[model samples]
Target: MSCMQHLVALLALCLSLAAVAASSNHLPGGVNLNERFFNQVRALIKRRMQEKNCARVHCPLSNVHLQPPLVDDEVALQNQRSYDNVPIPAASVPTPVLVENWPTEQHSFGQVTAVSVDPLGNPVIFHRAERYWDVNTFNESNIYYLIEYGPIKEKTIYLLDSKTGAIKSGWGSNMFYMPHGMTIDIHGNYWITDVAMHQAFKFKPFGSKPLLTIGKRFRPGSSVKHLCKPTSIAVATTGEFFIADGYCNSRILKFNAAGKLLRTIPQPPEFLSLQVPHAITLLEHLDLLCIADRENMRVVCPKAGLKSSHGEGEPAATIQEPDLGRVFGVASYGDIVFAVNGPTSMLPVCGFTIDPRSEAIIGHWGDFKNPHSMAVSVNGSALYVTEIGNNHQTNRVWKYVLA
Candidate 1:
């Protein structure tokens, strides 16, 4: 081997190594190849600038053109412009629009708060018969008698037809003080919660009266046999149900369809001790309970059924709620998880769908005055939102059909 031949071979090897390094500089190891071409172009331009000038100085936007070209900035700019011009196809994004305002003749609602769809595809809702919620005063106990309690009194719960949004039939009058959450089981049972009264009731589907009551009316207690400001209930297909006894208790209770208490799970350790567990939705298929830790502004998942005692509160892994003033209601309709947040003052009244696995917010709609509780249909095609009203007296329910 001659000296010149050795030098030539070494030079070729160095040139090859340089070429490999240059190729690697633009193409990252773990990049998604199918990502937008412009995105790749932008990444390449950025890497070129970083590699060519490690000593680049920060300058004001006005003086950006004064500096030497560390890299071809125009190429990056042109690529970005091309990407910006690429319009997103309409089919890829969800189109959510208000389908109905639930306008029915003589429809007088006093802060209709909790809304749910029954097995037969009817909207079942619960509200205060005479009283409406006032966020200003926060005296939910007082009725103030909006309408005279005549011979025919107010009905707190209303069953509305899906197509008409007209009041089909009503019940639960003189039963709930501050109606909060409501749900229907596969067996056609109605479960309701009252915050001001701190009680939960199990009523036959559309029954005129409650069959069994969990907590005593006007009584707030946290025990196996008692509940404190119970907020929500999730019923399983087999007549089993779970309640978020979270408003004040910081716990969840499981019970059989026969009104027998099974177990209680206090705040798990993850939420720095579960602050304000405002709402919960049961993902029966996944056997997971999605809970909104409202005060902390995040969502968590607990073991599906219930627990005996408070262990280290480890919220479900990788599930996070959206950033908002408060998250009040959550519902899982098959694979979709829906949550609504706000009181216009604190945060814009809005509703959004969440990714069940990642818990990332996917879509949003804001126009509510003060939405408190929500419900989704069996097919995951419709969303029902009940508001407490802007005046704390706005009695309205908005239905949104997902497209």
Candidate 2:
């Protein structure tokens, strides 16, 4: 027999022997030793299988190019401690004013999950249509199990004119289970994440079918072939992309243009363990990859191409304000970073701009019911925010322009 078959047979023999022994001898306190032993063996086998699968699927990196340091070593040390003493910019910072009666037609939506400005400056929205995410949307394994009224046929992707907000085109019918995040790469390709599908997709401009798909269908795993409820994706000009495997696996995974596994971004020692990396935004000008560490209520900015011997590196900067609430999304225009947060006991629902270098809160804007995701215009003249809406009703996307 082959090596794998022989190993499997050996494991089966050991399990059988354990079962026989456990049935004959009872553990103290009336515990069922057979059940306990079986559960332990099952967990061990599952973990080993996952590791094997990951090793088999992922390609090893022999040499990784690292980006130059964002700052001198001494200055970097100072910035590391800047979080506690960040200077609060004056209130004179400009806050974008909401444009009223926008979209003109006032199209209705179910739950606006994500919004991104395409290369042509048009806003593309990813919504849930008639589907809703609730307590039972995912089972214990983080696999989407709630299918209501069969498959939803509504178009989930909508491309609107940047000026008039009129729908230019729409597609994505009968595809995706639960839409979570969307981003338009520099090349105009759409990178989207589906929490229910546990997958990320890359679609050509106005394309109905995806040109590339990552992760296994309906399977939630941390292996190279599986993603556990991935939340968002950010693509670099070089075609390298980062995916926030948020819901279950709290890690950002990097992949190449052809969808090859690259590496799992290492969490910075200074920051708390990632709870849920809800959104990711790449600041190309600054060579920074920023993440919305949702439950941790912080934005971790790591050097874009920085890698260690193992093809992973620490974050260069972070924004963790007590009053920032739960940061739901992050976007960047030039060196300026923009973040939006849901309401909390200490702060109202608001969006704020930050100076990435100084890690300071520069400006703030508010009045959102539930700001879930956002996108900034290429020229830094406008911002678009998507709201899941209150009570699962009044789902809307709002546009704001810099004054």
Candidate 3:
């Protein structure tokens, strides 16, 4: 017989012998049944088995008892004396299975929108926290208390040290109106989006001052400066940036190194019918910009200038959105782009990779709910996702080791 077949036969023979030996044993309850029986079976397997995946083998002795070690008569007396006819209280819920190695990061009251690996391999999470002051004016909650008579909404961006699991640095004290998106560029500048403020801002690595603003005095109902909301951002290798104009606006705004508006790529009429343009990416070749048309549920590719609309150089191709509905973050590795799906109210973050050439979804896996944002490692094998779940009552981030 072949080697594998021979090994299988040997295992079968050993199991049969074990069955016979176990049945023949008649040890009393006082015997150390777990120690003796398990040791014997383990010894047998080690001598005969040569499986690569097998590091160790285990054999159960019998059903494990819940009672503390004591004489049978003693246990019966305690049970009988408990009460007249009252029964022992039973646990109402089933025990939960604990997972090892996987650690969870929790935040009190903030939504993590962006994450990047620091120099030491720890993650830096940027979250927009809310501070309530009455009902009318509440900016994104950076501080915990309400402003006496301040704006109903004030948004702030914080730089959190995921390693120490603390807020490392914060900038937007009373500055931001609705800080929705942020990214750390190669030059170390932080690019943030303030949709309510109608501006895209660039700040020095932890600086509170805004280095530059894209749309000043921009407001809704006016296409001159910006439409209504500005949502997400992406930076290219050369330091140029793309802003996904969200809400009332449906366009991709491009800026140069000096932060001057270079061009505007308005969305196709078909896509503008949707609500927001959430995330954008500059393809590796510098040949195009990939726009995550959030409401439209598709990634749109536009050539260099990203002109007004797609005719020839825009959207070289497009991929159909996954069934998960809306996508928040888009990252590219080689020729594939990965998207994070589901809301922040659940678990089992879902992700899918797309093959740009075929405009086809290459792979998909489920089990995530309410993942606020996601980022892929420089190498393409690992994906990090931030989760905000309700019942869990935790704001956490998880890393998935991709096969």
Highest-scoring model, TM-score:
2
lDDT of 3 by residue, 113-190 (tens): 566553333455655465322344323332212334343243344455433445555555666644567766666667
Compose the digit string of candidate 1's lDDT tens values, residues 1-403: 3322332344454345445556454434544343343343344334334423432553222221223434467777664322122322323334456885444444667777788898788888787655655663233442223223331246777888888788889876655556788887776788888776677888886576678888775656766776777888888776778888876777877778787877666533334356667777877655667887677666677656433233322444334422344777887776457777765232345666565543345455646666778888876677788877634346777788778
Window of ten residues with lowest summed lDDT in model 3: 87-96
Stretches of candidate 2 off by over 4 Å are: 1-94, 147-150, 267-272, 306-312, 390-393
Tell me which residue pairs clash in candidate 2. Answer: none
lDDT per residue as tens, model 2, 273-350? 788899999877666788898898888887677333322346667876544668898988766788998765424577
lDDT of 3 at 298: 71
In candidate 1 the C-alpha lDDT for residue 191 amounts to: 83
After superposition on all C-alphas, the RMSD of every candidate to the true structure, in Å, is 18.5, 17.8, 22.5
Q: Give the TM-score of candidate 1.
A: 0.67
